[model samples]
Target: MTVTRFAPSPNGPLHLGHAWSAIVGHDRAKADGGEFLLRIEDIDGARSRADLADEFRRDLEWLRLDYREVAPQSQRVATYRDAADSLRAMGLLYPCRCTRAEIAAAATRMGPDGPVYPQTCLHRPIAPGPGVVWRLDVEQAADLCGQLTWTDERRGEQVARPELFGDVVLWRKDAPASYHLAATIDDAADGITCVTRGLDLFHATHIHRLLQALLGIEPPVWHHHALLVEADGRKLAKRRDAPALAERRLAGEDGRSVAAELRHGLLDTGISFADTLLLDA
Candidate 1:
């Protein structure tokens, strides 16, 4: 069965962007006679909130988006740990003691996420203690996997370049698994056939493709949608205080109407796609 998912973090209230992504996944699944699953990505211990997770359910109900719930990521740490263990057994994961500040100081190039890690700890001896992050050796993994590509529903075939991110962290000191590791493991474990998210995550698919190869998991087709941005043309972000959908509901706005407006690209600011930082398709 073709399965798509709408995975959201429980760190904040749902915004218009979240609603649009959920609607997109729901409609796609319905159209293909498949299933739309919901997964709560609350692996970040520092930011995740139980109350916010409850609000996520209410927001989805308000939007009338029904889905079968997959096991929450917070409860799946063991599964992720096991996957990491397997990768370690393959010699693809290595312990890194480099701190964030250290990497920032050493990095010379920037990728979509941030500074491309310079792999300072790739060959360094593993520290004899905890709090060590495990980074994937992208170059070695790519050499073993050889040329790889993935299908993007809109852009067609894309050659995988996992090295672009340069040895991304699979396991973190603060958390058992990083976003890239957890998302890939859950998607494959849950038998997801199609992955739908925003274009901001398009580059992430490259590293995911490599992980899927090394882990011997089935790869899913990707659909990267344009992100919803603010009137000022910056991407909508929680840090920037993007208006919450709950606030709109509190003001007596209909969820269906909001979904409709989002579908048609109708926003209060009337900004076009070009106005935003849309990357090349």
Candidate 2:
């Protein structure tokens, strides 16, 4: 049976972009006679709020999107820790103590996630101390796993090249696990058959495919859909002042109608669907 999930962080309210992603995952699961699941990605320390978490549930209910809610990432610290320990035992994990500014200054090239880490701390014999992030050695891991490939419903077959991301972080300095670690671990644990999200994270799948191989977790097929953007071409992001769905709902917009419009790629706000499909192609 196919299983799909909509995992949203509760640090901010859901926006139209989030709505589109969730609705697509829900519809895909329904079409396949499968189950849809909701996962609260609230693992960020201190930044994630219980109030915001409640709001996330309320917003989903307001849209009438049904799903089985899984335990939030906050409750799964031990699982991530164990996974990190396993990787460390294999010598594929390293301690990185570089600050953001240091990384920015050192990186000569850029990847999808800002400046690609230069792996400055990869060989540092420094003991795990304060502000240390756990990084996975992508080159060593790929060598161990040999060539890897993953499939996307929209883009077809893909050869995984995690090296583009350099040695990515598995456990963050501030959080129990990075998004890549937590999402990959939880998806496997929840038996998710398909991973659905926006195309901005399309490159992230390469790193995820590597994690699945390294962790011995079953990989899910991916769906990297287009992103919702404004007329000026700015992608919708809370930090970028994207309108929150709750704000619209409070202003008397019908949640179900909004969801329907999002599902059909229709929005009253003149939000353009940025075609990331060609890039994936």
Candidate 3:
């Protein structure tokens, strides 16, 4: 059966964008008679709060989005640790002492996204160092993957160009698993066949695809829906409360009215498929 998931970070209150994503995931699953799962992506232990988790539960329920089951990421550290351990054994993960300052300075000097790291730590024969962050050895993994192909509901067939994205970090020093690893593992475990989320994650597909390739698994079909944006044309965030749903509800807005407004706004954003195709290329 086709399955989909709405994995939201429980670090803040759900907003209009979260509502749109929840509706999309639930409606898509209902249309296909599939299962919809709720995943709590609270891996950023330092930032996640229990109150935010409670608020998320309330907001999603208020929006009437149902799921088969919910998996809180904090409980799945062992799963991620195993993946890290296996990669460490395979030499695909390396311990780097690169600090945020080092990465920031490197990127700034490169003048913008300038291939941070320059793989300075790649061939270093140094022993496991302090602030050791685990990075995926993309070049070697690409040699194994050769080529990748995945289909998307909205974007059609997609190809990953690892050459464009060099070795990416899979786990931070303090976190056992990064967003890419934990999310993909959850999807595969839940047998999710469809992934419908906001377009903000389009760049992240490369990282996710590479990890899936390395783990020898097939990725789910992607449906990167246009995100809900504020009247200022900025994408809504969980942290920012520019146009939160709570405010709308406080302003006496109903679900039907909100959904209609969002649907209209999404298609009327002056962003046409033709334009997206050109830009995505």
Candidate 4:
């Protein structure tokens, strides 16, 4: 059976964009007789909160977008560590000690996207810096998987150029796995044969696909759906101006109304969303 998940960060309340992503993820998997999992990606300790996590679960369940299993990235530290160690053993991983200022200076000298590390620290001592970030060297990655191709159900044939994803970071200096690492690892472990997510991450297909190749895993079939946008035509974000889902729910608006608003908001984006998903809620 196919498996897919709607992973959300608990730093803030779920917004209209999240609702749309949840509905599409759950509905698409169910339609194919697959399992839908709920993953709480709260690895960022500085921003993650128990209260927000509780609201995350509450919000999805309140919308009736149930999942077969639930897991949190915070609880999977060992998994990330093991993966990093394996990459290190393969010599595909590097410890980067560059600070923000150093990077900015390099950028100023080399031009934007400039300085790109110059790979200065690639073979040098990290000099016991404040923090270290683990990066996967892309050239080594490409030698492992030449020319990867990902076909999304909606966007079709997406390709990742080797240069764009070079030296991608997998973990921050503090040992917490970056979003790129945690997400791909969870998807692989959960048997997610089909991955459905928003279009805003549409470019991530290349990064994830590259990571899959480096990790000796097969890329899952992707389905990048239209994103939930605001009236100003901006993509909705939790930290920004998107309407809060919890607030909307508490303000006497039912799930149906929220779903309608989402569908209407995404009308120009060319995706079919059903209001019936809210009927049971």
For 1-281, candidate 1 gives per-residue lDDT tens digits of 77999999888788877888898888778887899999999988889998988888878778887789889999999999999999888899998888889989999987767788998887888773687888888888899999999998878899998877888889998878999999999999888998988878888898899889988898999987877776666677777677898898888888888877877888766333322224342
Model 2 residue 250 CA deviation (Å) reads: 2.4
lDDT of 2: 0.87
> lDDT: which is higher, 2 or 4?
2
- Model 2 scores a TM of 0.96
Give the CA lDDT, 0 to 100, for residue 204 in model 4: 60
Candidate 4 least-lDDT 10 residues? 272-281
Q: Residue 76: error of model 2 in Å?
A: 0.7
Q: Which sequence of candidate numbers ranks them by lDDT, best first?
A: 2, 1, 4, 3
lDDT by residue (1-281, candidate 4, tens digit) is: 77889898878888766888888788788887888888888877778887987887777777777686466898888998898888888988888887767865664233113344556567976653457787788787777889888888875686765455356678787548887888889999888888888766666667788888878787889887776555555567777845677886778766766665665663434334332111110
Q: Model-by-model lDDT, in order? A: 0.84, 0.87, 0.71, 0.74
Q: What are the per-residue Cα lDDT tens digits for candidate 3 across 86-197?
A: 7778778776777667776665233112444656688776576456777878788777778887776777787876545456677777666888788878788778898887
Using TM-score as the measure, which candidate wins?
2
lDDT of 2 at 132: 83
The TM-scores, one per candidate, come to: 0.94, 0.96, 0.86, 0.85
Off by over 4 Å in 2: 277-281
Candidate 1 local Cα displacement, residue 127, angstroms: 2.2
TM-score, model 4 to reference: 0.85
Give the Å error, residue 68, model 3.
2.6
